[model samples]
Target chain A: MIGEFSPGLILILGALLVPLLRGRLRAIYMLALPVAAFAHLTTLPHGDLGIIELSGVSLTTLRVDKLSLLFSYVFLVAALICVIYSLHLRDTVQHVAALIYAGSAMGAIFAGDLVTLFIYWEAIAIASVFLIWASRTEDSYRSGMRYLIIQVGSGVLLLAGVLIHYRQTGSLAFGALGLDTPGGLLIFLAFGIKSAFPVLHAWLPDAYPRGTPTGTVFLSAFTTKVAIYALARSFAGTDILIPIGTVMAAFPIFYAVIENDLRRVLAYSLNNQLGFMVVGIGLGTDLALNGAVAHAFADILFKGLLFMSMGAVLFRVGTIKGSELGGLYKSMPWTTGFCIVGAASISAFPLFSGFVTKSMIMTAAMEEGYFWIWIVLLFASAGVFHHAGIKIPYFAFFAHDSGKRCQEAPLNMLVAMAVAAALCIGIGSFPDFFYTLLPFETGYRPYTLDHVVAQVQLLFLSALAFTLLMRTGIYPPELRSVNIDAEWFYRRAGRSLADGARMAAENGWKSVTHGIGRTISVVIAYVQRHHGPEGLLARPWPAGTMALWTTLMLGACLILFYL
Target chain B: MSAHRDPKEKRYWLDDPANVTRLVRVFYVVCAALIAIDVFVPKHGPFAIEHWFGFYGFFGFLACVALVLIAKQLRKVLMRPEDYYDR
Candidate 1:
């Protein structure tokens, strides 16, 4: 069944042929592939597919486990919506790349071993860059290049780690290789880079917002989620990840709060959301792991929805920046409504998808007595509501109505948002379907009275905080400026270094040429003074005179040596 | 290029009575109601409906209103120079 004519691969592979057709037929063909893929995805049996051994080495692969299954299912759903959202786009490169990108991510989820996962992992990196480049602008082009470098660099690290890990343990499985050695740390770094852990996160805000509308949606779903999956598999229950994850959760909120580019803010929030999953993985309990996996599933759905709506706005009016957007609700109510659902879900409002999954991690934290970590995570949760949950929808849909009207996004965009919106609500309302796919046996229920009550209390107070801040004019409003992030290092420091090197090289060459010119001039001057017709030595030093002088000098040297 | 425009269009949300008053009233009613219910209501299921209404529904409504009003306010700030992302 794993290798059978599954639609996930088929739709992505079939999309490769979309460009060969012309006009409306091309659009229809591109659209048909994902629908077919979604159908294939939904039909797959919800249990492990057998692992394959390569070269007599067991890869320890499993397929259709609850965690992997949840992500795979959400990937298909998000992909279908993205396809519709991007139906009007004519870029064949982006179309093919997006399908391949989404399909390969699903491929990674279904992969049975570290090797298969690694293959798809690199495939995602290689295929996804074209979407960034599809924007076809100089900045986008440059950002895409940087994006490619970081992503491919991450793959190289993974491959190296995999080789070392294979040599160390003689197994190529994808689970619980704790940070016991250099190779393990290397593997963690590999996942860390993709997961956008702190300083490694430059590529996200740099690249995602730079992609074409449809392209950003595809960017939002696969890359970080794949890293989350890898981390869950490899480092779950590792205590070190708890603090790393906590920092990951908290730091991005400040950036998101201050960020002017609404899409980029979402990108930061993506890092924040990944932090929640990492914390869960760090907790490493069955319930906690379930939360991480479950959160990955919900994150993809709602985050994709947020990106889709923003993409729609960009598709129509051509801007998603808060400074450039507002009053869209008047013109595009359905899109606005869908975006709110997405926002609420991400904010962890009661009866939202986040409400169901996020509590798992927090409960795990408290149970494990990581009291400080729990408090920090709770703070991060409030920050999430402020930046992503409230800020994204508020600015794009209804914030001071920009009054500039464009046509609403096409039918496909609406359908995409609606589908994602439906999943966000469905998962929140009925988490059993989602929980049943978790890898660990879960005795915990997300909808218990205590869980619901506390989550409500948390989110409600957070909302209250937002209102107070807004009233006091203290909340950071989106502006029309670039906020500095780690990319500042490359953009400012890297550029200055290049400039400095060029200047030094220029000066060094100039000094060398000047010195050589002076030496040649000095030699010419000496020769002119000594060998000119008027000079005695130049005029009279014939063979006879030169020989006499040499004999006199030799006699004088002998006398001086004797003395 | 007409310099003479309605003063209301130039006013910020905090400066505008109509906007700020409406927002402040809504914020007070919602926040007070939710906090009151959260403090008073027994924390349990079924009655969890009250908690949801107090917290989720009330704030959710506030978010919607804030979004709408902020949308109104953002109208002044929105600029549409072609291909803003390109630069």
Candidate 2:
């Protein structure tokens, strides 16, 4: 059975068998499966794997290329790290869900045909919600439901788009489709939601932090990356993504700066990172594509690492609020350092993973003659230093001692953090390792004196700004409470509107009933005057009177119809 | 634990169990080990992973240290009343 299946399927199937084993064996299975899958994916030659004929449509179900390869590589790596992080977890459901979610995304990335991609795409949305629900909280449950609804809606739209695309072109090949068409626009919106493009982003901050610690790690890797994969595939070279991505890069930093929950702040940062990838795809050159693919790969790792550290804090201390945490370095110093590396990497500090990959996207923007966009990106980069780079670690770890000494995270969690931290510095120090995997020819060196010095200058300036703001008490303080986001449309405003409509309808019905009562009473009085009975109908029981009433009713109906 | 203390008596911030050095030492050891790993691992080739692994591993460790320290710092900023955000 394993021999007949592709290596990707084999890996997923092996993961499926993990829960059947107990204790240490499960951990081994979890760790080894992803490594094996990574080996297989890296080995595949770039070309069409095979074609499957479905309903007279020849669908390219598996295609291996530079673009898909980059994302699949990250997906596999994240699975391995999450497995290590959750090694202590014996929860079969969460374990199985994480694997299925990871594997399904891999399946989508390798899919050569639109139909096949759509199948795995929907699987991603469905399999992923379990991660959120695993938190076992009422708030998580409600948020999970909302997340599922939006994801499913995206899937439905994709399906509709696929059907229409097939009808219009009669081909199911997975490649770029124009946005000018109806079906094309539908697919774009579907990808947009998964990518967390602007207004469609509520599902991210709303549900991501609500997931189980381990579950959130997996969540960080798959959904947006897959959306990025889709956008890279379908909308590469789309002119609209340029401006859209520029706005995306700048808009979320404002929110991240204000967010109370550290994890939610990371979520906004995730959106900002995706903006980088969008710009790469928009540039649509070989260099740009490489930048996009490379950035996506780097992003999943660092972002997952960041989320994992936060998850550990949440797991141990029962809170991720910046306000509720501090002075824990005295008790959980490893976690504090791990958070610093993550912060530095995210801020694009020198010799970190982010320094190597993120620059490619910005350079691509500058090289592509989008200097104005590059300036915006520079501002966004500075903003990243402010929020993700400086704000997360400084406020959470070093800002003020909260005196909440939680134990160091468990051994498994430590190992996971260790593994992720190693990757961040390793990639930063040796850009060549990551550069070789780029889809474009990588003549661009990230560690040149000019680039490093410029980045350093940018970061220090932002740090200076952060310090000045904090000293002045103008920086938004992280406190325990829900902060509003785009979700307020559905969570608060939408509910309020619905309630108002319901009340109005209810009151309107009451008035109509009251009016009917008044009419009935008037008729009763007329009947009493005529026959001394309770109503006219009760008094007028004679056959001739009844016939006269029927004729009169028929005459009135005929007159109304003619009028 | 503090119920026996008279209301007139002044309290010290160091009195909390969270501020004790014993637990802090444990945190320090853990942080040191992670920093060691982050600083030295890639120079040793057997530990090297692909792009994503390297990226995640590096930041992830720093995040861990930051988490520990953030826990300490949070006490100063954290509000006692649950309705802190209400204002």
Candidate 3:
């Protein structure tokens, strides 16, 4: 029997048995994997449990701490919810992929050394791509390939950083790695890429919407949150991250405002939410860090809820494009209601999950004297509510009637969504219980009258602005269009650059080959001109002429030798 | 409630344009009332900016309007036909 193992190993190894079962048995088994892991995680003491020396270097496979434990619990919760959402899927590949993906994310969070984190990091990237490929569309295939390359590239950066850092520091410990050296900077970049740091963020919006509906819900939860956990562990209080987080918070809302794919809109919203957490980490106070981790927990559930609701709509209506979808509330009332809850939560309405967690970050920033940063964050908060909070449900479910009719989302889908929605409310209403799970101790209260009144005023007025903009026709309509983002550098400009390079190589080779052929032909012609039958050497000369020529050549040779 | 609607009435409550107008009117009152609470309720924050009456409300309103308007103009440069990547 096993004494102890990383809880993540359960899901990773259990995925192998998923194919052997069918239907309800498979669902039950899949659900049980996380449930068992969560129970095991709760029982495990906070210490390094699996340490073995490999080549004189001790590799730690399991390191349980408050931070890792918090992240692991959320990962398991997400895995269960996502599995429930996908219960109707007959596709075995998605089930296995999602299980392994979630497991790898959990593994990354608990890793005590860079090597362990790197292995699970790569595994997470490779396993999650199957979710995108499970869509089985040409677009999904190509998108998955790109996503795989960039994600694996991030792993490569992490591995390189780990090697360099080990050579310099003589250890592979995953601890506070400030950016004072090349290795540390490389590791930070790896985390930045995963966290969707501005320019590095293109892959997320590109690939996430391409995943199968249930697959996207799984996609939304794990990968980025792991990056946040890593960053919080290693790079907390780094000054550059504040600016980086600012841009990440600011720019995405603009893009989300015009993005047509509703799921893609959420992807942008996810980036904006990550920015909030990153800033919290940057502040690095107890309240800030606690706020960051807590906000991540809230984001996972509410963001998952939002994604699940849209997935339900996509499952029934067969379209998630905002241009083609509207007025779906009549046909799918429960989904619409759940979606509103998610919207309200994301908007940080009073007595919601977002309000409790986000307030900590904002308050922490102010306490830390990030005056301008706090101001910008306030603006970002309003913008987040405007785009994600208002635009998503407003455009998809209630803007105008696309006149599309369908059944409500399947029972399993509704159950999954309802569970997620309930959790969003539960965490919002009773955050005291949730606060116990935070890595840091705090006596912060979220229900202050001033804070509540301020938040409510901000949200309500944002809604009013939306209403006024719609009434005056200043608001852009949902349309069948695309917006160029940082991804434009790769998707269009990068493609053309590759094409141009190929064309240049082709022309260069053709010219070189043409010159070589021309020279060869010239040599051949010159040879034929003298040696062919019609040439002087080939002409039938008399024997006397040959003899005379030979005599002349002999005399010249004799003269030259004498000289 | 929707299931028990009259057969003669084809439109739901949300479908009526008048209800939406009244809702907007009520929304306006709600916004006004929310700001009015600032007078009676004590305000506290790290900075003096938080003490300004209806600061968040106005900031939220202006910020959202600016985002929309700026984003609308952004479309001029960033917007492409639906199949921009495919082509």
Task: Choose the strongest candidate by DockQ.
Answer: 3
Off by over 4 Å in 2: A1-6, A504-563, B1-87
Worst 10 residues of 3 chain A by lDDT: A1-10
TM-scores for chain A over all candidates: 0.86, 0.88, 0.92
Model 3 residue B73 distance off true place after TM-score fit, in angstroms:
1.0
Q: On residues A254-362, what C-alpha lDDT tens digit does candidate 3 reach at each position?
A: 9999989999999999999999999999888999999999999999999999999999999998999999998788889999999999999998997789999999999
Rate residue A343 of model 3 by lDDT.
Answer: 94
Q: Is the docking of candidate 1 incorrect, acceptable, medium or high quality?
A: incorrect
Every candidate's fraction of true contacts kept comes to 0.03, 0.02, 0.87
A367-392: candidate 1 lDDT, tens digit per residue: 78787888678777777887788788
**Candidate 1 lDDT for residue B24:** 63
Q: What does candidate 2's lDDT look like per residue over B13-83, in tens digits?
A: 54565754554556445444433343333331111221222333333333323332343354445324443
Q: Which candidate would rank higher by DockQ, 1 or 3?
A: 3
For the second chain, the TM-scores of the candidates in order are 0.32, 0.29, 0.85
What is candidate 2's lDDT per residue for A296-376, written digit by digit as tens? 887887888889888888888888888877656666779889988888888888989888888888877766778678867
